[model samples]
Target: MDIKEYIVIAIAINAGKTILGIYNSDVDLKLDQSPLTLADRKSHYIIKNKISQTKLPILSKEGRKVSYQHRRIWSKYWLVDPLDGTKEFIKKNGEFTVNIALIENSKPVMGVVYSPVLDILYVGAEELSAFRIKQASELLKYLTLINDWRNYAESLPLLSTINIFRIVVSRSHLTKETLEFINSIRDQHSEIELISKGSSLKLCLIAEGYADIYPRFAPTMEWDTATGHAIINATEGKVCQADENNKESLLNPKFIAGAFNVDEKRINNHGR
Candidate 1:
């Protein structure tokens, strides 16, 4: 059995369910001043327990800290954000997700991002390509049909696209640089739409071809972008540093994600 078809998908879905079960729990502040809730812990442990069977080391947002020196030695491992977009989850906006990715040699190779509230599941890998499953809560009921995932699962970056140049940005973390980047795009295109979204959905939008570009100039850890980066990578999209020549780091640098190449001028010129 494929690990993605069984273990990965099952764990994401179950974790999403666990998150929803305790939706209305109290929120606490983490050391970083970010919000934490019961759902985050519940989902983290659920994924931790299941993924542990894989025997690969895990680097999770909520798990015990693993230093970079130790992590640098790992050629491959699981990267997870059990509850992405806690703010959205708290707002009950149905825009949050549970993110999991496989990192090989510091690059994401496979990924799964599930939005439990929306019953949407997205899975992508070098071997399996990329797929978006709607009403994904019912996925378990048809486990045998996974080999034929293409029959029901929608392949990413859907064919139909709007004429408008859409730019998806984080609802909470739109930095001044991001706004200037959007303005730069507007300068070139007469019709431009700015989209406000939370969590990894911004990258997912690019993978789905709903948005033409996403400029992230704000702060984000590796776990925050790895899953989405894998999905974008699987779709033949590019997620790279603004300079385009700089290598990716643990804390991702200012970057642009898009299905097509974004002009280097726009990336380097923004809010610098």
Candidate 2:
């Protein structure tokens, strides 16, 4: 689908999230420990229904689980986390997001993440590249008249070698493994800075060039990182495998990183 179509779908799904989040806040907002919520369920339904029009198979957090016996046969599918960051949503911090990613051969090739509360959308595809689009403030006047407003793309700025390295981490799910990884890097890179954020926005920061790296050591399903990973890859970054022996070392073709102009040897050495 084209970017315009994806934007419309994203906006519609985000509207559902906003409505449910507002309506459910007064009801005690029970947490399932797993972070399930009415907003998550509702948003999942809305997004699933819309994407169902294409008759594509989907592996969603809220949807029925097809056995791996059957799913392993498919070459392409949609991986979705209808509502990411249930903790932030319940806290009313507006850091949650809606994620949809197209996975092919165990890798996400396209992704769209929409934050309704913030009115920000991040879309990426292998061929089209990745971009962040936001609505114009003045366009709010035509909200009723115009179904979709024009969006301005946010581009990544150039980085200076001496600039501080900003690392993005999860606010609610920090783990010992993650800490060790951070410590290992900090020992070598003294200027490293940490920015804790909720949900898939961690990857968005890297895509937008706001952060240099994001190390996720805790358990996360494929859907959780697929969308953001695709966007990061589009921006000349990659998500490679973390070294089994050293948490700080990134394993090639597994760990993800954005595109860098440096030689492969330097990139591999830097991660180690």
Candidate 3:
């Protein structure tokens, strides 16, 4: 791994420390009726401190949202959601994650998703394919020997054991539109499996071939799915905005990740 990648992993691991600490604490409410603990704030601070050194403007869920006029002028920027699946964290389900993505021309060019409770990390870039470390040892082993972590990552779309038309969906925020999509698919395919997953890890699971697709009909911000979009796109997959035909805007939009052929296209990483 390059020094920049190593630094990002280190920052994510340090932020995980804060996340786990807050997970064990009493949970409460944040904005939009969501939960926020010290983890969110600490992770945001740690990631911003390290990533800011790259001199790219960062857009994070915790930080103030930048005006479109200001952000559109940039050719590149950092996108992050310091703590994803806070509800799962509050539930102590060990499904929350840290997400970071690099946006070039409003498209995710690189991404990293770390699950502290699972001790796993998923990374992908324009220059490299997507990969997942089954167990990252809380990033300790990576800190000790970066080469080992880099060498051990399993490539995306791991061989599937079953020939099932699997569909992975959000565990907490399932919508009627999503259900309708699933029902429609079941008519064409005989063997259908619905997998429940939380956080951006839902996208990683699809990249790993655990699920065939992730069709999210509910709303999502760019930060929430940019890293996942990058990782999946690296695997020759697509994460598109289903609402607009042009799909040029990167604001909130409906997202569906898989090998779907759609008129509106937002090509990411150009198949790597």
Q: Identify the candidate with maximal TM-score.
A: 1
lDDT of 2 by residue, 126-168 (tens): 8767777665322343444332432346543235464777778
Q: What is the lDDT of residue 103 in candidate 1?
A: 83
- Using TM-score, rank the candidates from best to worst: 1, 3, 2
lDDT of 1 by residue, 22-53 (tens): 66444433333233466788899999999999
Task: Return model 2's CA RMSD, one decimal.
Answer: 5.6
Task: Output candidate 1 Cα RMSD.
Answer: 3.8
Query: What local lDDT does model 2 show for residue 197?
Result: 94
lDDT of 3 by residue, 2-51 (tens): 76667677777778767877666555543333335567888999999999
List the candidate 3 regions with Cα displacement exceeding 4 Å. Answer: 26-35, 137-146, 242-250, 259-272
List clashing residue pairs in candidate 3: none
- For model 3, the run of ten residues with the poorest summed lDDT: 263-272
- Each prediction's Cα lDDT score? 0.79, 0.65, 0.75
